[model samples]
Target: MYAELFRLDGRVALVTGGSRGIGLACAEALGEAGARIAISARSRDEGEKAVRHLAGKGIEALYLPADISSESAAQAVVKQAAAELGGLDILVNNAGIARHGDSLDVKPETWDEVINTNLTGLFWCCRAAIETMVAAGRGSIVNIGSISGYISNLPQNQVAYNASKAGVHMLTKSLAGEFAKNNIRINAVAPGYIETAMTQGGLDDPEWSKIWLGMTPLGRTGKPSEVAAAVLYLASDAASYVTGSVLTIDGGYTIH
Candidate 1:
């Protein structure tokens, strides 16, 4: 019974930025649960590699090369995924970029790039997915957010990233309220410091690693699979009654 609740048989899922990091992990988890997977990334090489990885696990998957920051690309990826996979049942807005610098010194282009990719692009993906889901009368969206949306991180200056994720948190709520009547659910997962390629530079720095571990009650950084598991629950029937919620997988970092 428990397993059945999490099974995604006959469902189709699209995961953006799925070539690596948390996105790839989410795709793998959803595929393992029996969902057909479509992964989109800016790099064709990375996308193909991700597809190969999923295939090695005996999961049916497709690679869609796309830059989600472009509205046309975002819409096209969703349309192609739906056409190829039969339909869209789940959407994971996991593509994001972060730039760290003093707000006073940050370039306009840097800020624009981060906000556009992290927030605006995600909205486009959600909007496009909603059209199909609403027609079908059922769908689920699990956005990958950051605990930075909740609390400012020490020693790192990422005002743009924090602000963008905060936008995502609210966007999830607003969309959920509007789409609930259509049998569509929108939610987000706010993960703390995870060991991913994006954070490898910081993690490799002894001082940064020590500071992060000290702040986290778990005493270590989180793994991509850990975050992926939370995403899986939200994407599956297990969360039928859940919506407009932000599940924090932060290893007790916000306790203070």
Candidate 2:
């Protein structure tokens, strides 16, 4: 009976940016736990492939297309997921973009793009999902954040990304406080130097990798599945009492 608390059978989940990297990994993990999945991405082909992969694992998954940078598009995604998947019990805000520029040279347009996609888009999805979830009286939200929110990466400056992620941390807390009465929980997962396509450049540089490993107590970069595990834990009833929390899956990179 206790084991059932961790089971996600019959739960419906919507994961933004679910075509690849951390989002796809979370989708896979949740699917394995028996949750029906709606994998949303801007790339139709990738979204279809992700859904197929999940389906192959015996999980009911659907491909929903949305570019979360557009507020209207983000809202539409939640509506479609709710309509098609029956209702959403989980929402993972994993859609984000990272653009690097000198802090002083970063243009307003780029800053706006990063903020719109990473922070504002997350709000739009949460707002839409909450409409149905509030009526349902139960839901779980996991916002994918990054260690860069707390500490900036050297060499490349991404002030917009850092600010957006910091906002995400507070956003999760604020939403959790407001929605706890509705039986809805909101939490965030901050990942450190994960080995994803976005970070391949850093890993390819032996000197950079050495510096990264030196900073990371684990002496290695993290994998997407590791971040997915953190998400799965927060999504499941195993974290029923957890809300307004930031679970860091950084492999000790933030300790120093």
Candidate 3:
């Protein structure tokens, strides 16, 4: 009975930015749980590779190349995924970008890029997925947030990223309230510094790595699989009672 609680037998899940890192890990976890997977990414090479990887695991998966920063693309991706996967039972808005610099000196274009992709794009995906899920009367939407949303970082200045994630957290709660009656659950996962392609540069930097390790009580960076596990729990029936909540997977980084 406990094992059956986590099974995703007939579910279809769409994971944006699923080519690598945390997004890819989430896809793998969902697939392992028996869900048909649809992965979206901006790079065809990466997307195809992810598809192949999932196939090797005996999981049926599709790769959709899309830039979620554009509303049209976001909508199209969802449509394609639903069409190909049979239906959309779960949506993971995990696509995001970060721009670091002094808040006063950040460029307008950079700020817009960060906000558009991190917050606005996520909204578009959620909106499209929810529309379908509402009609079906059941669905789960998980947005990838950051620990930065709740606390400022010391070695990096990423005001836009932080603000965008905070927006996601609130958006998750608001949507949860609006969709609960429809049997759709909305939630966000706030992950701390994780080992991903996006954060490779920072992790390789002696100074930055030192600061991050010193600040995190775990004294080490997190892995994509760790975050993915939390996402799996939230996306599965195991978390049927969970919604409008932010699950922090930061190794106690935000405790201080």
Q: How displaced is residue 244 in candidate 2, in Å?
A: 0.1
lDDT for model 2 comes to 0.92
Q: Please give me the total number of clashing residue pairs in predicted model 1.
A: 0
What TM-score does prediction 2 earn? 0.97
For residues 165-203, write the lDDT of model 2, one tens digit per residue.
999999999999999999999999999989898788878
Which consecutive 10 residues in model 3 have the weakest lDDT in total? 52-61
- Model 3, span 127-207: residue lDDT tens: 999999999999999999999889989899989999999999999999999999999999999999999988899999999
Report the lDDT of model 2 for residue 155: 51
Query: Each model's RMSD to truth, in Å?
Result: 0.7, 1.1, 0.8
Q: What's the lDDT for all of these models?
A: 0.94, 0.92, 0.94
